[model samples]
Target: MKEESSVSRLQIMSVMGLSKQRNYLLTQYLQAIQLPRGFGGDLVFEFQVSQGRVRHLVLDEQASSLKEQTVMELIRRSLLAWLPEESRSNR
Candidate 1:
């Protein structure tokens, strides 16, 4: 979803392969997070999958109108992107 290209898809697949190799659960049917395309126009989508199904799917229409919340989510995602999928303690 980051970029609509074959290379991006391949990167995602590669990460999934790495996750499996590291014993991370692969049962999540799908996982996605979609931020609003425009302010106050669309809902923010956050979907989490567990046990081959959706455990939570938050659709916040108001999030688009709340600049603070949107900024927080952006920051959170950025921070998360910087984190290792497996903590050092796991090794």
Candidate 2:
């Protein structure tokens, strides 16, 4: 039972880490005016905010098996964690 719980925890953490990595990549590509039309098999996140703040994160070759909705949820969670503590925008 303990081993099972530990494995479960690790799996959850792995998902979270993947989400964070995707977010970080997106932040790096925010300003890209042109991107590959398709990345073959990868999870891509295009995050956009007001005032021209745009972020594009990608998890190339590492997220092909995940559903689109799942990936989106991960993106949402990562963004929520990233926002400034003082920001009034509620989830």
Using TM-score as the measure, which candidate wins? 2
lDDT of 2: 0.38
Error of 1 at 22 (Å): 17
Evaluate residue 73 in candidate 1 and report its C-alpha lDDT on the 0 to 100 scale: 66
Q: Locate the minimum summed-lDDT window of 10 residues in model 2.
A: 5-14
What are the Cα lDDT values of the candidates?
A: 0.37, 0.38
lDDT of 1 by residue, 1-91 (tens): 4974322110123232234633233212112234344333223545453433333445455654344576446534532343233443444
Candidate 1 lDDT for residue 8: 11
Model 1: runs farther than 4 Å from truth?
Answer: 1-41, 65-91
Clashing pairs in 2: 26-56, 26-57
Tell me the number of clashing residue pairs for each predicted model. 0, 2
